[model samples]
Target: MIEPASYSATEVLRDGRTIEIRALRPQDQQALISALDRSSPQSIFRRFLGARHHFTEQEISYFVNVDFVHHVALVAVADENGKPVVIGGGRYIVIPRTAKAELAFAVVDQYQRQGIGAALMRHLVILAHNAGLEELVADVLASNTAMLKLFENTGLSMSTTRESEIVHVALGLSLPA
Candidate 1:
């Protein structure tokens, strides 16, 4: 069953809007799928490094299916026009035998700048820290300046390596005592 108490937050946006950030539930598969379906091709490419019309059964299963230990996933939702919708999502899978995790995030095209992605990242980072993770890494498209700027705003160790069209970002989360 989905445990909201373990990982959930309702925060106010900069513009007085409200959003709920919580652990993704199994029932959220279709909502997420639809969110992806509504994402622009460029946004999809920035998130996945390629274009995908939709998530396959296996892929969607992997998304909403999380152990909350090694694999943590969360979604940002808000009421739009009296109906709740998934605006953004973030997740991190711990690297085998390491204090690091691979992270990813995707926001709906319409909700790009309403702090959804930033909020998701904050929540995901807290989850990762609680789960004993030390770092988060992702390969972002070089052309995706918005995502890169978001990563920079996190104030983490923010190091990157560029290879062709992709930029690998490694943000160290474990701070020294």
Candidate 2:
């Protein structure tokens, strides 16, 4: 497995502002909290699939301390008044003994529709493909049309299953021959 900590890239948003995409670090716990504070409750609900205001100690640890091999994570950092801030993040957790992983992403409310999520998805796809993963899956709320459209725009062969109010999206990582 490659060192996920070594992963970093720069992305240009729709407004022509540059943002850095890098691996999530243990020290980023506070930044994550700040980002969450900047996000709207509706945005949080879509990403988490429910309403949540606080993360437990265990949950924070699990989110920050990634193994890089099975649980890979990346964060989007943008300049905020000359200081870099965590505005968004994406991750994939490989299902053990399988070539499939579940994907998740979150971008602060103010930064939505600025292409941050797409940038994170592009980087994560590269990492997952290099790691020999065959597919990435996400469980998005049916009401989250933006996220559903983002997955659709990935250009990957996708299949979705609707269960109640949730849409399970599976994106094939391998290119067609």
Candidate 3:
């Protein structure tokens, strides 16, 4: 029963750096496209864990135009000369017939390990909780140790399994008292 309009932008400070966490704005479509376009081949590979280096227009539209009622998209940004640059992003999609959500996140190459991804994930977790979700799940490649560590250190209960060369992780969020 969360109202998307009530969500507000907030800044998180980690390791002496400040990053903005907020819901995606309509004006950010071009910035997101540019960020996706500028992503390195390896970054794309790590995020999607495949040779698919490009995103179709339909894919971009779907990611940006999530149904606000049942899904939420949050982005981490750094402003350069008054224009916001997308450094990281995460989204939560409610699963039908379940109180769990599927979470996905990616940080730009230059911003990795600087707390951008964690900040984005933390914000998205709060959003999911506000929306009454009970858990968050992610599918990550086995080789992506950074993502694994992020989830592990988040203090959530998680289980992992190998699927071919990829790893699937499921995290159950602790309900807020």
Candidate 4:
């Protein structure tokens, strides 16, 4: 009976820095934008799987606003000097009328390889399972080895299919984590 919308936890990065992982709030819109700004073009391309410039108004709203049931999103926040900065985020959106959800994640370029992405994946999987989702899927670029490895290391029953330059991964959630 965990509420995904109000979910929160503290995670330590590989380098031993502590971060707060919590539900993405509407007020986090600006922080998301700031994170995006801090990311390099290569990191953005890896996350979005394509060249992207900016998000439209509707896209920004969709990214920040979640229904908590159908769409669940979480963000990793860390203290930067005196301000809280959004370092990374992950989300799962249920497929209509299906027991599966689509997963996505993005970590700030500087935070890459610090186990932030893994932390986000772990939290998202828990929320998905609590929400009654049977599986989670992700479409990653063929060149994104880190993401593919993250999925593989989850210890869930997983399968992958490749199409063109994309690798689609599916992870069954019923297995014990």
Q: Which residue pairs collide in model 1, if any? A: none
Q: What is candidate 2's lDDT per residue for 21-81, written digit by digit as tens?
A: 9999999999998999999999999999999989999999999999899999999999999
Give RMSD to native, each candidate: 2.3, 1.0, 2.1, 1.1
* Backbone clash pairs in model 2 (N, Cα, C under 3 Å; residues 3+ apart or in different chains), count: 0
TM-score of every candidate = 0.93, 0.98, 0.89, 0.98
lDDT of each: 0.86, 0.95, 0.77, 0.94
Give the Å shift of residue 86 in candidate 4: 0.3
lDDT of 4 by residue, 1-177 (tens): 888889999999899999999999999999999999999998899988888999999999999999999999999999999789999999998999999999999999999999999999999988998888999999999899999999999999999999999999999999664
* Order of models, best lDDT first: 2, 4, 1, 3
lDDT of 1: 0.86
Q: Give the alpha carbon lDDT tens digit for every residue of 42-147 in model 1.
A: 8898899998777777887888888888888888898989999998899898889999999999999988888888888888877777767788999999999988
After superposition, which runs of candidate 2 have C-alpha atoms over 4 Å from their true positions? none
lDDT-better candidate, 3 vs 4: 4
Model 3 is weakest, by summed lDDT over 10 consecutive residues, at: 1-10
How many residue pairs clash in each candidate at the backbone level?
A: 0, 0, 0, 0
